[model samples]
Structures are given as C-alpha cells and as structure tokens.
Target: MTKVDILAFGVHPDDVELGCSGTIIASVQQGKKVAIVDLTQGELGTRGTVETRYKEAADAARIMGVDWRENLKMEDGFFQINEANIRKVITAIRKYQPEIILCNALEDRHPDHGRSSQLVEEAAFMSGLRKIETSLDGVAQDAWRPKYVFHYIQDRYLKPDFVFDISAHMQQKIAAVQAYTTQFYTTQTADDEPQTYISTPDFLETVKARALMLGKRIGVRYAEGYLTKKMVGVTDFNSFVQETT
Candidate 1:
C-alpha cells in the first residue's frame, strides 16, 4: 500500500496553495511525505484554462516537494457531496493512508470549497467503517482513515482551535503559490482575461498578513490556523511552548 505522512485535499488547484502551503512545506521539511489531491481541474477559474491549471498545479507540487499530486477531475463548480464523490475520495484516502489529512475550510467563499470538505470529512468517517466497501483497480480496498483531519482557514477567518508556527516556511509557501503563474498577480499576461479576487497583487500580501495576525495571537512570527471538530488531546503541556516575555 502506498502511504503518505500527510495528505491535503483542495476543491480547486490553488486552494491548497493559498490556505495551507506554509504548513505543508514545513511538514515536508521535517521529513514528512506529503501529497495533494485536487477535487477539480479548476475549469471554471477566471484566469486560466484547465490545461494551464494542470501544468501550474504540477509546478506547485514540485515546489512543495510533495510526493504526489492527483486530480479527481470532478465537475469544477457543480460537484455534489454525495456518496459517489465520497467514495472517490475514500479511494484516495485508502491509497495514501496518511496519518494527517489537511482538507479545505469547513466553510469558505466558494461554495465548492465547503462542499468538498464535507465530502472528504464524511468519506474519512465512513472509510473507518469496515462495512463501507470500496475498490480500486478491480481489487477490494481495506478500510483506512487518517488519524487527524485539519480544516485550513480560508477566505473567511473562522476562529481557529489551534495554530502551527510556520515562520521559517513562509517564503517557500509564497513561491509555491506563485508557481501558478496563470492564476495570481503578475504584470505579464498570456491573454486578455480580466482579474478576479485572487488574481490581485494584494491577495498575496493579504495572505501574509493573515498568517502574521494569527501568529501574533500566539506571539509567533508566522502561523497557519485550523479548526477542529473535536477538542485535540495533548498528553503534556511540555509538548507546547509557553510564550512569555
């Protein structure tokens, strides 16, 4: 079985890049094997064609040093969080069997983002149930679910249950996002497409500011916040540093 240390799921190609690339890069740098599974080809994006998004996703994956990145080719804007989609995600979850799963924000600006998170969350829960059968390549797959599921903060700032210090990995995160040249801020244009909310130059700066703001809450230089459905358990306080001046 092909297993990864962390598996991130995004509704669109750049959602992962914008939301949690810093933490992803940090985890990989710490010797964890990470992978990304994009639920859509982002065909509905304003700035880039599906082909361009695919190439850009590949570039971002390379920059993130992810072990693998896969696309499910789901309908970009209309995909539903139904059994079929749940099973599709389940197959990838079992294939990777990651210890941690980084999923889209529970709720976000794009309806698809929240929907994708619900689909993945339901799939993860069902995957742990042995009775829910799934198959791939004509073979029956074993039930597998990630130990932890973290929903990254996105367009809307939902209060995070916790945050990870990512000061050192911030630059790498920006580079990964910039890898999608067809999407974000750039003077050079391949076509005469109009700019969207994400294509603005300030978008990147806003991302940095958001991280900094989150970090400040915990007295850190940078951090990515996440929400948890359940309270996280910690065996000892020593595992977390106490900030004191």
Candidate 2:
C-alpha cells in the first residue's frame, strides 16, 4: 500500500489543474508525497475525447510531480452520491491512507463540483468505520481516515478559509493548466475545435487573477485557497509572518 501525505480529488480531468495545481506543486516541491484521484474521465466534455483527457491528465500530473494519478471512472456530469460511488471513493482513500484529502468546493459554477465534494466528504467519514468493509486486489483492507478533508476553492469565487502560499510555483502551476491544451485556450488547439468557457484567453487570465487576489490576502505573489469544515489551528504565531509578494 502506498501511503501519501495528501490525496487530491477532482470530479473531472482538469478540475485539479484549475483548482489547486499550485498547492500541489508547492507541496511536492517541499517533498510531500501526493497523488491525484480524478473521479471521472471527463467523457462529457465537449472539446476532447476521453483518450485526450487521460493524456493531458498524465501530462499535468507529471508537471505537478505527483507520485501517481488514477481515475475511478465515475460517470462524468452524472455520478450520484450513492453507496456504490461513496464506496469507490472510500476505497481510494483507504488505499492511499493520506493524512490530508483535498476535494472540490462545496459549491461551484459546475454542479458536479458540489456533488463530488459532498460525496468525498461523506466517504472520508465512512472510510473510518471498521464495519464498512473495503478491499483491494483480493485482500481485505483496513479502515483508514484522513486527519482533515479540505475543499479547494474552484470556479465560483467563494471566500477561502485558508490560503496556501504558492508564490514559488505559480508559473509551474500555469504549465500544469496548459497541459490541457484542448480544454483550455492554446494556439496548439485545432481551428475546428469549438470554443467553450474555459477555452478563452480571458479564462486563463481569470485563473491568474484569482490566484493573485488570493495571494494578496496572504501577502504572497500567488497562492491557492481552500475551505474546510474543521477548524484549523496553528501551533506558532511565527508561522503567520507576512511575506512580500
């Protein structure tokens, strides 16, 4: 079993890139082991095929330096919060045994984000119960629970409970986002491809702007934001020392 320091969950292939690639990049740079779990192949996306999503996700994962990444193959845009789906998420949680779990926002412009957020949150709790059994490869699995589950602030601009400083990794984060050439704006995309909300140059600017705004709050050049149901406590006040952006 490969234990990780953090397991990041996204409902679609590029959700993690758009949402928290900076945080992941920073964490990996700091030597924290991380893995990404995408809930779906993004089969419903208009611009790219499932095969393209897999390749782009792999490229983004490489850019972020994750230990590994996998998709659970949940139905994109339509996965329900049922026992089957929850169990699927729970199995991944238990398999990785991460100390921290990052997931989609509680609410977002895309409805799937909220739904997947709730599903992962619930599964995180259920995964700790000894009676709720799950196994991998034919062997029985032990019950495991993360110390905390944090939701990354995506699409909708909700106030973050805490913002992570990712000043050093902003450009790398953009590179990770740029890996999804078909989904986001890039000259490499074919002319016949239809333009979607994310495929615009302005959309990329908003991604940069959002990080800038969040970074400004924490006195950093760029950052990523997260919301959590649990209260985050700090041991030392010195940790809050402001740094110039």
Maximum-lDDT candidate: 2
Encode model 1's per-residue lDDT on 1-245: one tens digit a residue. 57899999999999999889998998888999998999999998888799999999999998988879999999999999888898899999998899889999999888998999899989888888899888889889999978889999999989999998888889888888988888887565455788778888899899999999998888888899998796689999887845644
Displacement of residue 11 (Cα, Å) in model 1 is 0.5
lDDT string for model 2 (73-119, tens) is 99998899999999999999999999999999999999999999999
Question: In model 1, where do residues sit more than 4 Å from their true spots?
Answer: 187-191, 242-245
Worst 10 residues of 1 by lDDT: 186-195
Superposed model 2: Cα runs more than 4 Å off: none
Alpha-carbon lDDT, every model: 0.89, 0.93
**How many angstroms is residue 9 displaced in model 2 relative to the true structure, after the best TM-score fit?**
0.2
